[model samples]
Target chain A: MRLRNLGFVLLFVAGFAHADTAPFDLSDAEHIKAGHKRFNKTCAAYCHGFQGSGGRAPALNAPDGLPPEQMFTVITEGRRGAEVMPPWGTSFTPEQIWELIAYIQSLRSTAPAAP
Target chain B: MRLLESIRTSLLSLIATASLAATAAAPSIDQAGSADPTNWPQYHRSYNAWRYSPLEQIDKSNVKHLKVAWIHQPGNITHGLQATPIEIDGVLYYISADNNVWAIQADTGTTLWHYVPKLDPIVKEVFYGSASRGVTVGLGKVFLGTLDGRFIALDQKTGKALWSTQLTDQRNEAGALFSSPPQLAGNVLFGGTTGGDQPTIGKIFAVDAETGARLWTFEIPKDDLKSWPGESRKTAGSSAWMPGTYDPVSDTIYIGTSNAAPDYHPYSRLGNNLYSATVLALDPKTGKIKWHRQEVENDSWDFDSAYEALLLKRDGQDLLVHLNKGGFVYVLEKNTGKIQNVWRYAENLNWTDGIDKKTGKLINPVRPEVEKSKLLCPNLLGARSWNHGAYNPKTGLWYTHGMEVCNYITSAPEEPGPKPINALTLGLEEIRLTDPPGKKADGWFGAFDPITGAQKWKIRYDMPGLCSTLTTSTGLVFTGDMRGNLYAYDGDDGKTLWQFNAGSACRGGPISYSVNGKQYIVIPTGLGSHAPGFLAGAFPGIKDLPGGATLIAFTLE
Candidate 1:
C-alpha cells in the first residue's frame, strides 16, 4: 500500500509506522552517472535546469539541502499537486528512484559526472 | 467517327459539371467541423482550420459591455484546463485533466452529466501530463483520446461509454499516448500519437468511427530504415501530437508532425530524418500520405512542425499556411506539397542564417554541437506554443503570438535506456532559457496576411500569451495572457477594446458560439505547465501566478 500527502483528513484514516531509510550510495560514480543521464534526458529538458543548476523547478545542486527520507518519500509519493512533477513511484521501482535520488545528491558532491 | 468522339466528350463534360454542382451543394453533416456558427464543433471550429466565428452580436462597438454570464468548474485540474471545449446546439462538452468528460448546458452553467474514466496507473507517467487537447462531438457521440493508450467514444446525451479501443501498446516502456481528440472524416476517426520526444516510434492512425476498429496506421517517421539510419530509427521521435483539420475542397487532411527522437543531437542520426518536422496531406479514409513537405532537416533545436495547417485560397490557387515550431511559416500549394512562400513569425531567430526565398530552402542552419552549448532562439516550445492561432477570413489576416526568447543548449548523444525510464528522451547536456540579446524578453500578438506575411498591427505583452486566439466577424480578437488578463482587440488595427481578469491564466482555446439566438464567448481559465518554468527565467513574477480551472462564458449585457 502507498500513502500520499493528499490532504490532512486522509491522514486520520490510515496510520502506519516508518523505518530508517537506506541511503543510495552517492560515492558510486556509475550510479551517479546513471542518475545524471536520466536527469539530463528527462528533467533537464523541461522542468529543472541543466546539471540541476535550477530553472523552473528547484535546484538540486546542494546535497545537504534535503533529508534522504524526505527525498525518498517525495520521489516515491510525489507532491499531490504540481505544475509538471509526477510520482516517480508509479513508473520506477524504489531502488530505481534511489538511483535517481543518489544522482541528484551527487550533483552537489565531489562525484564526477559521466560523459 | 470524329463526330462521335466529340459527342461523347461533350456528354462527359456535362456529367462532370452536374457532379461538381451536387458536391458543392451538399452539406457535410457527418463532418466534425461543419462550419456552423451555432456551435464550436471541432478543434479548429471548422475543417478550413479557421477558429473564427461569424457571430457579430457583440461587435467592437459594444465589446466593452461584455459581461460574464456564467462559469463552470471542472474539478481535478492538475495540469490546469488546457483542452478546447466543444459545443453543439445548446449543449457543451469538454475534457478535464485525467480524461474526464463533462457535458453542460450551453446557456446556463448546469452540469448535465460528468464522466470519469478508469485510467491505467501508468497515466501518471505521461511526460506532458496526460492532457487531452480537447474532445470531438459528432454523430451523437463524443470521442476522446486518453493517456493510457485508449481512444474512447461516449454517448453525447448521457455521457455513457459507447465503445473503447486501445490504440497504443501500453507495455512498451517508451510510453506513447494520444494528446489530441480523434478527428472524424466520413465513417473513419483518426488521431495522432504524442510523446514525440520519447524513445518510441510515433504513428497516426484511422479507426472505424462507429465500431472503434482499427482501419489503417501511417508511421509518422516513414519506413524506419528509409529516413533514419541504422538502429537510431528505432527511437525516432516523430509524432502528429496536435490535432489536424480536414480540407473538404481537396478531400485531404492536413497535419504537421513532431521532431525526431533525441531532439537536439543531430550527430547520431545523420541525413534529413524523413517526415520528422514535416507537414503531410493525407487521405483520411486510408491514412495514406498524399504529399509531404519536410520543414526542417535533422531538426537539432527540438523544433517540430506539428501545429495546425491552416487552409486558404488566394490568387486562383489553393494554399496551406503552416507555422513550424522553428518560427518560419511555409505557404504550400494545396494539391501538391510544393513550397510557394516561406516567411517567419518569430522576431528573434538565430538557429538559421536565413531562408532561401526562391527555392524555400533553409540556409546556413547553426546546428547544436556536442560539448558546445549554442544559443538557439525559440527553444523546444518554438515561436508559438501549442495554443493555436486564429485565421479570420473577414479581416484577411492570420493572428498569432510570437515569443522573443532564446535558450543555451549543449547537444549530447542520448540513447534509450535499458528500460523505459521515468522521463523524456532529449539528447541534451543542458538547456536553459535566456532573454533574447539586445531586447527585452517579451511576447507579442499580431495580425498578418496569411499568404504574404504582411503585418497589420501588433501588441506586445509583458509575457507570452499562452492560450489560443479567437476572432469574430465583429472585427475583434480574443486572447489571454499568463497574468490572467483576457483582452478583446480590434482585429484590423490590434487595438485593445476591452479587458477582463479571468481570475486565473487562460490555457484552453477561446471559442464563440450561439445558443437559442444568443451568442456567447467561452474561455477556459487555468495555468500549470512547463511553460511557466520556461518563463521564470524571463518573467520572474510568473512563479506566483494563480492557477485554477473555470470556464467563463461572456455575452453582451
Candidate 2:
C-alpha cells in the first residue's frame, strides 16, 4: 500500500513541474509562427519583399544573421539611412519585438543551405 | 507801461523753448535703454553674432537650483519657433510661425503688440512652409524676412509696419522665400529658400536699412558673361535658408549656400556647379565676391553647405568655422578663403575618401552602380541639418550634434514617377545592421578639438535627426533631442550635468540672457521639419503628443 502511495505522489510532483515550465517553454515552431505573423502585419511585402528577400529593403536571411539585440534596436529605434525610418517601439511591445526576432530567425533556416 | 509788457512776453517765450528741448532729448519710447545688462539686442546679443552675454549672475554653483521663471505659451500651432528673442530695455521682440511678429515684456512675459503682414493674393499658392527663425534690430527698427520673400521693417515701440518690399520675384524663379532672419550691418543682408524640384536661383541682397532701397545684390551663380566675360551661364540653385554672419572690422558678410535643385541627379545640371555648395565671402557694401571655397563639388547627394558660418579669432588669427551637411567641419581663414583644416565629425561616412590637402578638393568619387543600389554614408539630408551650433571661446571647444547613418540609394534614370503622395512615402529603408551597435553608428553629440581637428569627446543617442546646441559662459553646453529631453553638458567634457523633459522635440537654438541681476536660459519647443520620425515609436508612452509652440525660461533660485 505504501509502495502504491509513493507512485501516486511522484505522478503529482511531475504534473506540478510540467505546469511551472510551460510559460518558459518557447517551442521553435511556436516562436517562428509568432514571428511570421508579426512580420506580415507590421512590415508587409511592401519593403522587406514577400520572403524576406532584398528589394527596397535589404535581405535579412544572410549567413551572418542580425544579432537578436541589434534586430530589436533597429525595429524599436528605427534605421537612419538616406531617409528616416519611423520607429516601432511606441506602436509595439517588448514581447512583440521578440516575436519579430523569432520570425527573422526562421528566415535564416528557411533560406537555401549554404555551400 | 509798454516796456514792462515787452519784457513779460520775452520771459514766456524762453520757458516754452526750454520745455521743447527736454522732450526731444528723451528717447521716443521709455522702453529703450542703453548699456543695460537686462536686455538682449540684435540677433546674437549684438550685431557681431558673438552669442556671448556679460551676465554672470547664474554661475555654475547656483545653476543646479534653477527653476522655471515664467512660461509664455503662445499657442501658435502653425509650425516651430526658431527665433531667439531680442530684448531691448525690458521688452522682448521676436517673430513666430506663419510670419507673425510679437513684442512682449521681458520681465513679465506679457504680450505688448502683435503684427501680421497682409499676404498677397498669389502668395497662398507658393510652396513655402510657414516658419520665421528670428529678427534683427537696428536704428530703432526691427527687421524680418517673410516666407513669401518679403523684407519688412517695423517700429520698435509699437508693432506697426514701417515699410515692406518684395525681396524676391519668385514668379521668374529668381529667388523663392526667406527661411532665416535678415542680418543687419550698415544695411540689411538676407537670402532665400526655393521650391523643391524647381529651377530657381538664389541671391543675397543688401538693402538700405533706413530707406527700403536695394543697395547691391550678390547672385550665388555669378553671370559668367558679366563677371568673367566668356564662359557659359551655368544654373546654380543654392537656397540660403540660414542666416549669415557679418564682420564689421573687415566689412565682409559670410553667406553659406544650399544644394543644387533636382537634388538627387547631378547629370541634369552639369559642370562643377560653382556656388551651390560653397561658402562665399562678399563685400557688404558692394556685394562682390571676395573669396569662395566650394565644400562639395558636383554634389549628387543633396548635401547642402548652408549651415551657420561662425566667425571667430583663434591665436590672434581671424578664422571661420562651418559644419557642412556632408559631415565635414571646415576651418578657413576668414580674410582669405584658405582652407586651414578639415576633419570628419561623423564616423562611418563613406561619401569621400578624404579631402586633398593641396587643392582642398573633396575626393568624392561616384560609386559603382550608383544609379543602381549603392550604400552611402551620411545620407542626403546630411550629418547636420539647419539647426545652428554654438562655440565657447573660453573653453575653445565647438559643440554640435550630428547623425551617423548610411543609406542604400537607387537613383532612377529619370525623375521618379511622381512626388510621394504624403510625408510617409518619404520614409527611409533599413540597411544591414551596423557592427558594434551601441556607439550610435546612427546619431549623437560630438565635441571637436578646434586646433587639432580631433574629436575631443562624443556621447551617443538612440535616434538620428535635427537638433541644435548652445554654449554658455558658465561652462555648460545646452542641447535637446527629438525625444523631447533638453540636456546640459560640461563644456570641456561631454558629461551630462542635468536634463529636463521639454515635452516636445526642440528644433531651435537656445539663448541665455539676464534680467534684474538674474540669469535665465530660454529655448523654444514645438514640432517642425527637424523632428525625427523614429521619435513616435521610441517614446510610445508620449506618442499622442500635441504639437504647439512655447518659450520656456529658467532661472536659478
Top-scoring candidate (TM-score): 1
Judge candidate 2 at residue B51 and give its lDDT. Answer: 56
Q: What would the per-residue lDDT of candidate 2 be over residues B1-557, giving only the tens digit for each residue?
A: 33543454355335334423343332211111112334566565543344555566765666667677777766564555667777765577777776888888676678999888886533433434466788887667888888667888899888899888787865455336776778875555555555322445567777888777878776676554432122222234566677787655566678888776545555555556777788888877787889998887766666778777766666777677778888788888878979888877767677788787567787856532323666666755577767766666667677778776555554432323322111111112222222222343456787776545577788877655355666676778777876677887877777877778877767776777665555677777765543332222222222344445777788776
Give the winner by lDDT: 1
Top candidate when judged by DockQ against the true structure: 1
Q: List DockQ, one per candidate, in order.
A: 0.36, 0.02
lDDT for B128 (candidate 2): 41
The lDDT for every candidate, in the order shown, is 0.78, 0.62
**CAPRI rating of model 1:** acceptable
Model 1 has an lDDT value of 0.78
Model 2 lDDT, residue A2, Cα: 86
